[model samples]
Target: MIETVIVVLHLLVAIGLVGLVLMQQGKGAETGASFGSGASGTVFGSQGSGTFLSRLTAILATIFFLTSLGLAYYASHKASAVQEAGLPDPMLQIEQAAPEAPVSEDVPVIEEDFTPASAGEDVPAAPE
Candidate 1:
């Protein structure tokens, strides 16, 4: 459940990050002369980033980075000691009861004389 929550959070952060990046206006809203324009001076200043969308984009990007680092750390450290996920061992199964002891010393084992076929030697016989 915790892993599910973390995965959901990671997905939301990724979507938000992509949306924020796509919604941001590029450095040049319009193409002026090829040479460096005066407008370039104000691009990185407080004026450009003061916009609400820019602020939100920055915040969401930070969250995306934080979650990415956190997930990496969790995968490396927290998951190392986790147990193998599988069905319970058959020897410890509780549904069946223990077997009884052998009843007679002279009882012949029915399959004692039979030998198992070799891997490549056996071609199964079809039905009669």
Candidate 2:
């Protein structure tokens, strides 16, 4: 449950960080604001928006980093818990459960004929 909460907070903070970064104006945007582009009439006021958005972005980034660490800790903890449970690994269980091939006694075996050939037998000659 705590891990779930941390994961949700991490996602929310990540999205908020992206939105805050997108909302902030670039350095060159000041040229447009000076020429009556009306950027100065924002809800947070002219200079206020810059500092407020930057600070909020920083806070969200910190939260995102912390939640990432929390999630990693939970993952490692769960892995360790599984190890402590003394359960056999699934792969080993699968190999142990497989049936071995059956041996058959009906198949005929070839035997070598060690009898000497008669003197009149026609044997192929070896290559010279």
Candidate 3:
């Protein structure tokens, strides 16, 4: 339920943001082209207190933040949800064959004489 609501809100914001942006003129647009104001100083402020698109953008941005928070909150608490409701260990239902023992190839072995008995034998009993 929570996820659905968040997704809906997210989608709505995405669409609305696009539409709102398209409806507003670009920054370089001529002020006098449409309203003939020619960038004149306004009573509201230098550039006007705020244009409709700017205000709408602010509102949509706030909604986007709220929906994002809602989604995060919902995700954090979703551990209690089960993949399948009222089902017990559905994965155990499938039967799997037993694993086979691995076989190894035979290899020849080489041995080396490391003892020191032959070393002193060559001395021929210095004090026998």
Q: Find the candidate with the highest TM-score and give its number.
A: 2
- Residues 31-85 of candidate 2 have per-residue lDDT tens digits of 8766777855678876648788888888888888889989999999987887799
Query: On a 0 to 1 TM-score scale, where does candidate 1 land against the true structure?
Result: 0.44
Give me the overall lDDT of model 1. 0.69
Candidate 2 displacement at residue 17 in angstroms = 1.3
Error of 2 at 18 (Å): 1.4
What is the Cα-based lDDT of residue 29 in candidate 3? 66
TM-score of 3: 0.48
The Cα error of candidate 2 at residue 86, in Å, is 1.6
Give the per-residue lDDT of model 1 (tens digit) for 30-68: 455255555446655534543777788778878878777
Estimate, for each residue in 17-117, the C-alpha lDDT of model 3 and write its tens digit: 88887777675665554677644465545464348678989899899988988888777555335433545434554533444566656755779978776
List candidate 3 stretches off by more than 4 Å: 31-50, 80-128
Candidates in order, TM-scores: namely: 0.44, 0.65, 0.48
lDDT of 3 at 79: 37
